[model samples]
Target: MGTLTSILVLSFLIFFHELGHFLAARFFGVHVEVFSIGFGKKVFSKVVGNTQYCLSLIPLGGYVQMKGQDDMDPTKVSYDQDSYNTKAPWKRIIILFAGPFANFLLAFLLFIAVGSMGVNKYAPIIGKISENSPAFEAGIQENDRIVMINGVLIEAWEDVSTHIQESVGKLELKIERAGSVQTLIITPKINEYQNMFGEIKQKKMIGIAPSGKMIEVSYSADKVIGFAYDQTIKATTLILTSLQKLVEGVVSPKELGGIISIVQVTSEASEAGIVALFALTALISVNLGVLNLLPIPALDGGHIMFNAYELITKKAPSERVLTSMTTAGWLLLLSLMALSIFNDIYRLTNGN
Candidate 1:
């Protein structure tokens, strides 16, 4: 049941992402050759109007193939009327940008609804301190309110978490104690522990515990909308930063995950009820949106980059160049996928 639910939720995200491109292409008067809900051999398909819509065997990725997408094939040209290439640069840009934009919009809606329900916040106040731990050595007293870490202002307990997890040893923290603000330096000690995912992680520990507070705060409609928008952007930035670190070899491959990990996480969130599930859904949705926007060939961001170049240089990149880049992108993506799956299998076998 949990696996089925996870698949359904994932399919929903994929459907909306493809729908964004399909709608945008149609709106721009572009002829869509294929609108698929999944990849590989078509399981079910129907030709409607000018488009062949399909649900393929593999439920991974879907695509919107527009006329003149590869090249200005005179043979496939029905009419120049609203062909993708014939559109003005700005229109073309918007159509290409719409897919990711739609993902962002979906994330924003999810966040707004979640926020309106009043998010449970973990206070900055430290509840417990472990003796002989990093926090104790750093003089992080109990009841101290963490204000900032390494000069970055701390909002919720998550802020502290992000800082602590990502930051290297020795970080300066600002805390408010007895109405006086003081600075303390702490080094997060690396501790090998089995994480919730049952994988061993060299977790950074400050040894300070958090206390949660549930408070309903009403915000104006605009604020709710803005909060959603900001959250999506912030989440994207964090994902990108993590990716950069992984690429730079600062993070371990064990941190990477495949479908099994996602299902595990989804099941856990589902067990936490509707609010937690919604929040998790929004997080994953935003992550998907951001990943799709990476400036790699075969992605929307790559297409957008080409369009931008075309607009600036007044000449489209050669089809051969696009094809080569996309092929390479596929190879790189497949390699990463294989690595993640291998990691998953190894962990499972080792009882990680």
Candidate 2:
């Protein structure tokens, strides 16, 4: 059931992405030939207006086939008024960008839903303090709830870390212990820690850990929009940063996972309940948005780049260049997909 749910969710994401392109194309008076939910053999198809909507055998990804805009074959061209090739380069760029934009918009909405449903956060209660650490030397004890830091209210464990890292010298922490409030002054020391990307870095630390107590926080209507926007931006930035690290070889390619891993993790999220599922879905949606904007051939971003060049130069790329680049893009995409699948299988076999 979980696997099925994952597949359905993935398909819905693809559908939404392609719908962006389809709608944008139609808006500009371009004829859309086909709107497919996947690549390769078509298992189901139906003609609606001038566009043929289809479900393909592979459920990995999808595409929008606008007239005279064939990613598979750049040689195909039509100069008709309603064809994509006849549209202005700027207009075409907008049509290309719409797909990724839709993914971002969907992610933002998903985040809003998550915030409305309630987000689980660790309570600002100290669990452990390293010996001789700043927090320890200051007489900070386990089970003490951090109420404020440097005159700023600390609502969650996340707030504690932010406050500590941004502190200049001494931190004034207000804590509640045994229903009594007390203030403590502690000077944070530079400490080495491993980040999420497995990189070691030095940062200001008080050496305090959360007590593993969770609180469900639901945002108000106005606050939920801000929460959603912040979450969306953060997710987008995280994906972009991770990609940059991967390209710089700071992150090993062996850590990459494919559709199998997506399905597996999404299935687990489903079991964890609605909030987990929504958060994961939002992250994946943002991931799709960021990836589709990469400046590679045969992608939405690549096509946008091409159109932008024409818009600037008043000339389209030569047929030979377009065909060669598109072919190369497909090859690179396939190679990456193969590598990610291999990593996924390896992890499954090794129980990683």
Query: CA lDDT of each candidate?
Result: 0.79, 0.93
Best by TM-score: 2
> For model 2, which pairs clash?
none
Residue pairs in collision within model 1: 198-352
**Decoy 1 TM-score against native:** 0.73
Q: Considering summed lDDT, which 10 consecutive residues are worst modelled in model 1?
A: 70-79
Q: In model 2, where is the ten-residue run with the lowest total lDDT? A: 60-69
Which digits, one per residue and each the tens of the lDDT, describe model 1 over residues 1-352? 7677777777778888878878888887888888888778999999998789899997766777787665322133233775777777777778877887777778888889887876777877787898999899888887889999999988678778889988976889999999999999888887888744344778788888885543344346768887787778888877887887778877788788887777778888888776677778888888888877888776777777777888999997886787777778778778888888888888889888
lDDT of 1: 0.79
Candidate 2 local distance difference test against the native = 0.93
**On a 0 to 100 scale, what is the lDDT of residue 106 in model 1?**
80
Look at candidate 1 and tell me the lDDT of residue 165: 89
Model 2 agreement with the true structure over 210-311: per-residue lDDT tens digits: 999998889899899999999999999999999999999999999898999999999999999999999999999999988999989989888988899999
Query: Could you tell me how far off, in angstroms, the CA of residue 306 lies in candidate 2 after the best superposition?
Result: 1.2
Q: Give the winner by lDDT.
A: 2
